[model samples]
Target: MTEQRFREFKMPDVGEGLTEAEILKWYVKPGDTVTDGQVVCEVETAKAAVELPIPYDGVVHELRFPEGTTVDVGQVIISVDVAPGSGPVEAAAAPAPAPAAEPASEAAEPEGRQPVLVGYGVAQSSTKRRARKGAEVPVQEPAPAGTYYASPAAAIQGELNGHAPVAAPAAPVAPAGGARPLAKPPVRKLAKDLGVDLATVTPSGPDGIITREDVHAAVAAVSAPVAAPAPVSRETTPVAQAPVQATPVAGARETRIPVKGVRKATAAAMVGSAFTAPHVTEFVTVDVTRTMKLVEDLKSDKDMQGLRVNPLLLIAKALLVAIKRNPDVNASWDDAAQEIVLKHYVNLGIAAATPRGLIVPNIKDAHDKTLPQLAASLGELVSTAREGKTTPAAMQGGTVTITNVGVFGVDTGTPILNPGESAILAVGAIKPTPWVHKGKVKPRQVMTLALSFDHRLVDGELGSKVLADVAAILEQPKRLITWA
Candidate 1:
């Protein structure tokens, strides 16, 4: 008889202390051959979406949960047959009907499950998780962190002691002729957000998954203005009803989107920051024609070639220079310790608006990077955020942040401070305005900048200097070279 063995891959705690994650997608199906280090699924945690790779090379034996199902950490999500040619596909796919029960001790903590926090691998009796339900496949423990396994994955977050994980909400199914519509959670959420009836959207994707494009097409079709009534040569039947954009659905007057994932985390953080910190906002307007010119010039510079060079790049550099000049403003208030924590390094955060909501992913050691290096980092950060791939780690430990409302064509407004950070700068749209330059009123590219900081950590004098320094640098591009 051929030897048969299976390797089970459990959901690892992708982020520090995250308790669960939703299986956003699956790349492989039963009977599909997979190689080690190949991504088999993508999952969305409370933080961000990440791709999970298989560490074991084998034929996919089964998927324990369907897509859009929220799975708790340490649950076996996929099984793979390590030994090939062991049996027919039918036998491998089906679980044994009358399998023998395992000994009591064998149902202990899984080998592949990882610790959720640093210095947390020690097994305590209080945190003991009950044995999971359904089929169990034994597998080797995962390699330690700092390997490929720990990169970019987010996890479900909650208290782990004596609490059963929350049941995943039912995935919304489009009405497809009394059969369940095939669509992922994100697609369903999109359809609902757009107020487009999924039943009206045609499915063009494989396996009938209603894609985002389909939902958008449906919205476009309904939103297109009714064509003006054309002159008719012959008499046509009088229209029974007036042309309307779209017939109202039976009962969609109100939408209560469940607050979870990134949106949930953001709301909590905002409320905490708002209540805990004392915010003071200061604003200044500056002529940034020279700085804007420098942006265009840098785009042609060989050293900066192939890098993203924009006004934001120069503004970021200006902020770094200002921080360097006013080091005290880079400090955070340690409320519990009753001390101001001054940071020597700057992890400059750029506030980005995503479909999931606002997120601030920082550049580590921004104070150390050269202009070109900073530009490259900014490019990567913006691109990663737009793709919704910003990891939890990328969003942590920010010292200061910048929110550019100018991208939306809005003038500057008082921005809120990111939690644990000293300040946030808001950048407004750059426009051509009449300004006094060298004793003459000329049309100059001007912009408004607003800086909001924690009053306890940064007094008026310190905050003003930081804001003034940035304005000075923007007014004179040479200050970056002189002051930096």
Candidate 2:
């Protein structure tokens, strides 16, 4: 009896060593044909929901776990018959289970690391504790490329943190220069689905990498409505993409929801941040009639066409300007060294309420972007979050954040600081209220702003100034021109 070769698709460590993930869904079943780089299953991690892509072209032999089962990283979740023509399913699958029989450590590092794209590969250096300016930042040398990932989705997917990308079965592509194009597996898959060539798309991502936005832009240039990657509905906040609870217990009025995945991660992080950091919240209510008018005017402006122009856009811009003026407030507490880490750049985080839970993903280098650029980014960020497709890389390195409780019709909230972030600003609902304006009582659009910060890192005066600046900008709507 000859044995057939089966490649076991193990649960990948999608987050930075996130131990386990619950299988949210499976797209392919036994006997289903799967091609290289095709998403076969979706898994929910402590951080985010990620789609697991099969690496090799083959037939699915078996699914080891059912939906909602939490499997440890490196455990075999599915087995694929690489040599599918050999025999029957039962016979082929029986001998093929050897791949899954191996220890997890062996499966994760069986031969060596696989080849990966440049920017999507392991991080070289990350900011850590520093005693002085001269101290060397820790760096991890990239493993020699040429590794085959057990699952490509596990390599790059995370809920609220960033991690490196893994290998894909597709050939590394480049333009006329012969240099390989840098892109994540998901972006590559999107390009393939839309019939857009990654090499032809001009990359707007940092380090000359192609992003999902770049792929969508390529489709936009071709003007193919059918080939567009996402929906036209622009929702600024996260909505329930999937049901949080399924079948209820028999004869029980209360359906118990298991606390795991994104909710579990969120709970733990919130508790840690609350206790670890000394929090102080400050509030200011200001008339934003001018800001509201600016939003309406921008909607008709040609420069702002096709972008998400709303009160939130102006609010985010106001917060950014505030951070610029109070740069010290845009810093983090380095507990390891007990030193203040002042950041020169800003990764502005937007707190979105999703069905999975509250997840905050940030825009990279937000300070350098122009207002239109910021609007475009905000549109993309919200659209991505609403679809539950936000990547781990999008959620990392946030220096500050903005939470709009106004979406829920709430006045304001004392938002807790995101881990490693110094401050969070909450915007309340905007409504017409009786106010004293120009020496007379009149009905005007007004809203309250709440600023919460790590009191250890940000002083009362600094936090107050940041909140005051944001309110001032919204009041005049012209300070954005002078301040920004």
Best by the TM-score measure? 2
Candidate 2 global lDDT: 0.70
TM-score, per-candidate, Cα-based: 0.69, 0.70
Clashing pairs counted in every model: 2, 7
Give the TM-score comparing model 1 with the true structure, all chains together. Answer: 0.69
Compared with the true structure, what per-residue lDDT tens digits does model 1 show for residues 129-227? 222233232322222211111111111111121112223333345365544356654455454444444666789999877876787787678673222
In model 2, the clashing pairs are 47-159, 48-159, 113-147, 114-146, 114-147, 115-146, 115-147
- Per-residue alpha-carbon lDDT of model 2 for 33-105, expressed as tens digits? 8889988877888888888889978987666654445677987787777887775544221111112223434
Candidate-wise lDDT, in order: 0.69, 0.70
